[model samples]
Target: MVEHGKGHPDRLAQGEQAITEVAADRLDEDGRHEGRLVLTPDRIYFLDNEHSSGGHDDVIDHTRFQGAEVTGDDTVGTLALNWSDQGKVYEGNTLELRTFKDAIDDQLNP
Candidate 1:
């Protein structure tokens, strides 16, 4: 898992800036997979190291981001991202999830 506050700015497109990122367990119908959740100016995406082929495993444009829900406490938990018609859940440290949610909210409202 990605350490708290660590980010992958190099993964961004040219001129794209990263707000924050974290290492989390992506919970899918298939199972949980280790990946990094990245927040950029234009989108939030997951980079699944186990299956990556030089592209995001999944992406949600900022325009499609509805909101986020954090379940758990200060030590550990899950982060649920609400999108246009669906949502995604990621399990990680509570502090990192909260920070990521706050960053997304700030961008949406800023």
Candidate 2:
């Protein structure tokens, strides 16, 4: 079987297991932007769809993560993630908040 999405999961980690993938977003100075969220056993990847004019990728280590949660209703909400890097706290999330949280929780617990 073949999988399809905005980005390629294979580009993440070679020979590593992929837990899940979803269309998501990341927090930036401008605002929330569309991105491809890929989950592995030990890391979370938020990569921008290269086809887009301005796209980038964020590789977050689970150990550096401080916390994560979903807020607001399905109508209008945000997926929030907190992490510490270089002594600074960083935030990352997607507009599909609930869906993002569920995927992360399932992988964390399963």
Candidate 3:
């Protein structure tokens, strides 16, 4: 996972660039799979892998996440980032404090 100070510029660029082999995976219960894609001023992270884990792996590679459409709630903020290639959608929630802990676990075992 990629961690940076709040409002890091690299994190912001991730939302705008075309990243390849961006780590993608799915949770057991259809929840989101959150992790970092790259480390730098511009990083791209993903929250959910529901679609990619299914039969859309190639679709995700073809599409590039450009921006997010946010839907906020009390506990979390959901985002649907638009992809450039296959019109695929990358769905995820805004990063939270606990997210870092989960990412650490994955790194140790992954």
Candidate 4:
């Protein structure tokens, strides 16, 4: 796929700009490789660096984003970000998840 900053070239819309992106550990599956989560002004993007089924990048538009919540703590283990989109749920971990999610949430919910 063509590259567009931190996301795929085919994933963006006109005038869409990436606000922030971070490397996240995919905790929803076993032996999963780390992925990238990109936040644009109007969407949340999950880019798979390497995935078992050969790969797929997920985009959750602001209207489809439900919420992102911390499901664990650094003290106990890696912090996990739990989020839902259009009735599907996803989980990933990143030291930056909370911060990134908070910022994205503001833009999505405001």
Candidate 5:
């Protein structure tokens, strides 16, 4: 069964492999949330520390992933994920953002 409320690695579904995970701040209209941005083969999960009490704050399936854009200075960057009708942004270390971009790009292409 697919786990919907937990944020830890143990919450991942069986046979689902994590491609990348990083400590980042998820940005939304309301505010920023500290969370782990986890990219798995089937979904992109924003596991927020504060908002994950009952349901997922954000979970984008691979088929819904449209594109990603990264922008920032030398030390930090923001990764913006674009999907069908919505988007999500995460701010974190520059290198980590690049890693996320690459992984997402690979998924989109392959």
Candidate 6:
């Protein structure tokens, strides 16, 4: 579950994980704004700007969504940056965002 200050907890589905209350500063190298995100066990999720709840007030000039991937297995996994603007929902145990995007593109183009 992910939650912010004084806000209700956002529930995650079974077999899913969430990175809640992510400060925007954590999103980038420099600490500039407040930003939060929720990552399911499979995919990373970006909340709507409104849902950012004034957390990302300083994160201007950014895209609506960015791509991400998870490496490793059930014992442990690392999240890494992948693609940008690739509309795919995460399910589980996939660490190559570009590969997923390619598959999606091929399916759409073919």
User: lDDT for each of the candidates?
Assistant: 0.79, 0.58, 0.35, 0.58, 0.77, 0.35
Clashing pairs in 6: 17-41, 22-35, 22-36, 23-35, 24-34, 24-35, 34-55
Off by over 4 Å in 5: 1-7, 54-56
RMSD of 4: 5.2
TM-score list, all predictions = 0.83, 0.66, 0.32, 0.64, 0.82, 0.26
Give the residue spans of candidate 6 off by over 4 A. 1-15, 19-21, 25-35, 49-80, 84-110
Report the C-alpha lDDT of model 2 over 1-110, residue by residue, as the tens digit: 01223257556767556566666655567566666666677877776764443236676677776666666553555556666732211233334455556767776677
Q: Return the clash pairs for model 1, or none.
A: 2-23
RMSD of each: 2.8, 5.0, 11.8, 5.2, 4.9, 10.6
State the lDDT of candidate 5 residue by residue for 1-110, as single tens digits.
12232347655657776777777898888788888877787988788778646265577888888888899998889999988879988899978788778877887678
- Model 4 clashing residue pairs (backbone): none
Candidate 5, which ten residues in sequence have the lowest lDDT sum?
1-10
Whole-model lDDT, candidate 3?
Answer: 0.35
Give each model's clash number: 1, 0, 3, 0, 0, 7
The Cα error of candidate 3 at residue 60, in Å, is 8.9
Give a tens-digit lDDT track for model 1, residues 2-59.
4323455555566666667888888989899888888877988787878646453778
Model 3 segments beyond 4 Å from truth? 1-39, 47-65, 86-110
Candidate 6 lDDT, 1-110, residue by residue in tens: 22322222343334454423332213344322323344333433344334345343322112333544545565333334444532322232233333333433343345
Q: Which stretches of candidate 1 lie over 4 Å from their true place?
A: 1-14, 54-56
Query: At residue 71, what lDDT does model 5 achieve?
Result: 94
* Predicted structure with the largest TM-score when compared to the true one: 1
